[model samples]
Target: MSAALLAALTATTPAAAAPPHWTIAPSAGGGSRPAAQDGRPYIYAEGAPGSVLEDKVAVTNPSAEPLTVAVRGAGAPDVRTKAKGPGAWLTFATRSVKIPARTRAEIPFTVTVPAGATPGDHPGAIVASGGGRTSGISVHLRVSGPTLSALTVEHVRVEGGDRIAYEVVNRGNTTLTPRLAVRADGLFGGVLDKGPRTLPVELPPGRRVRLTEPWHGAPALDAVDVKVTVTAGGGAGDSATATARFVPWGPLGGALAVLAGGAFAAYASVRRRRRKGPGPGTGNPRSAP
Candidate 1:
């Protein structure tokens, strides 16, 4: 085979031929009665403001070789790049651990809720990275207080005459599953009306997502006012509107060409009249004398 063919095959091959076989999950209850509690799929905790909660995560290595893993919290706090949610509240005793083959290590962690933390579900995850692979176990932390769900629709507009774009913001302290409805009014009457439908997105508290809706049936020539309404559970809803104008340029261009041709002909007639130099019966004093 050619050298180029050999190089191509080498490039397509993966660096790691063996698949990683390790797992991370929430630890079962600790102490003498460790088997007294049932197995947990994820970590769950609830506390009042200014409280400290404890939990444990387990990492298991089934491979023949020892495995070293790095652990950290992700999600909520990383959403807006600020330390305000449960992701930032996590504090592990040790962030790294090593386990011998066929062994499991349980690590303890603490979640310290701030004094002014809001009340709602602050979903996060404890992630383990090892052996060129990673695993994450979810953490559902809720603060004890009244909860609220509110959202807003903003920046609604049409794009490329075929898509409607907008932004949805979760303004409350609770996660929201939003539904969207679209309506457009034109010069003559309503041009487009799409009923409410669930958006394939879950808006976490204090986060915004930009989404687009298909507008394949948009009019070719009309001035339209598009209104977008978004609503979520718990009486959270808001609406925004934008205006767009569409013109059938193909037909307009033909009419403009005809007008241009007529203007050019009128100009030619004026030029020819000027060149004829005052035809028949036109008065000239020197010629009359």
Candidate 2:
């Protein structure tokens, strides 16, 4: 074989494509630096209504090629469109930026809290998109004002014969971690007593979540009254009740049939005694009169 043909057959295969060499993070200590400080994963801000707060996000390009990134707000309260929440209150100094190879760009942004905004945590995120990939840093903005922790339990009911389902709503201005208690009273006595336990849910203001609790020990034959009580810190609490009936018609029907037969037999015995009247040991009531 020729040397040229042998060399062509030994060529290496093409390699897979590489991922983008860029990152986005919260600016270090609100400084002009492009890297984040340790233990500072998200941007935090606090202000009262009608106040303006500022923050920065850093986008770094470590590759040898220059990168252009498009920045915007995401998640709840985004300001990019007509929406409510902290995202809507944010405004960026520039929506697009170009960083040279091995450089970082720090973009500034402002959050303007409306005068009528409620007091509580309004979470949002700043996102940067480049090279078909995206990165984001969270923004935790808490408004200063009177905070209330209140909730409501609604639509309580039994589901699938083995679970209790209900809806919990946060009616206060602050977020709530609710604790739930379930109880059931039957015709005889208390049949279900589930003590209070912390629910794996985070209820934000004006949000309602539907959740279910396992009721594997539900009564097999009873008309039960179920109640769900939800409480959270900051004086938030509510209760709701529903009724469920679980009857085994197979057994109940047989019992009813036996009782009917016994009543008929007792009636026949009483009639026979009335017709026979007095015996030899006793006088007749009609003859004495």
Candidate 3:
């Protein structure tokens, strides 16, 4: 056998491979429930727009082997894309850490809220990544703003009996549990008068949701104007209106037809009486003679 051929037979080919992402799932520090009762693998912090808050996060490694991970703060991924909020404001002590097998590490961090920060929830994440694999703990940050409720109802319309469709907008910086009071008025008087009832919704700031309200049996024949008034926590409230016309066209047409027939009969009776009178005189002049 040739030397070159023997070398080729023993040669081994390499396969493509990449590193994996890893991180520890965040939990409450005390192992008890969070203050806000939000059960998420996240760091929750609240502060004013021009303030700074401090907190510590524990990163655990349940793996059997030793590993070195890069710990950093990254922008929280929004429903649409990455958020450019609190993530940009977080500052960490160390950028990387080496952990032994089956151990945990505690890292302290501070969040500095900008004076001009928007008053609302700003999300971010603390990521631990190595060998291409990445894991993250969510950061829920709320910047303090005026404690006010602001809500508005829009695009209100009556679909049918008791079925009112409307859109509610949250124009405040907090989550709201809204209530609705639907009232309807007709040409004669009020038809529906429903007081405020708690809505089955949780509206986040700057969000809009469409909902329907029920009415058992609405007016059968009348022109109605519907008004939907909504209110919520923080004194947030607004009103909107819609119009509906419900008439029994079948009965109306029949009644008009009967009146027209009666007028025709009266006209025939008058014509018969005129024909019996004298032609030129047009009246009964000495009829007996």
Give the winner by lDDT: 1
Q: Which regions in candidate 2 have their CA more than 4 angstroms from the true location?
A: 1-18, 31-37, 62-65, 75-83, 249-289
Candidate 2: tens digits of C-alpha lDDT, residues 76-160? 5422223487767779999999999999898999988888777776666666777666666766777898888888999998987
Error of 1 at 188 (Å): 2.4
TM-score of every model?
A: 0.82, 0.71, 0.55
List the candidate numbers ranked by TM-score, top first: 1, 2, 3
Clashes of 2: 6
Can you list the residue pairs that collide in candidate 2? Answer: 77-85, 77-87, 77-88, 78-87, 78-88, 79-87
Model-by-model lDDT, in order?
0.81, 0.79, 0.72
Better of 2 and 3 by TM-score: 2
Clash statistics: count for each candidate: 0, 6, 7
Residue pairs of candidate 1 with colliding backbone atoms = none
Error of 2 at 51 (Å): 1.1
The parts of candidate 3 lying over 4 Å away from their true place are 1-26, 30-43, 50-112, 120-140, 160-162, 248-289
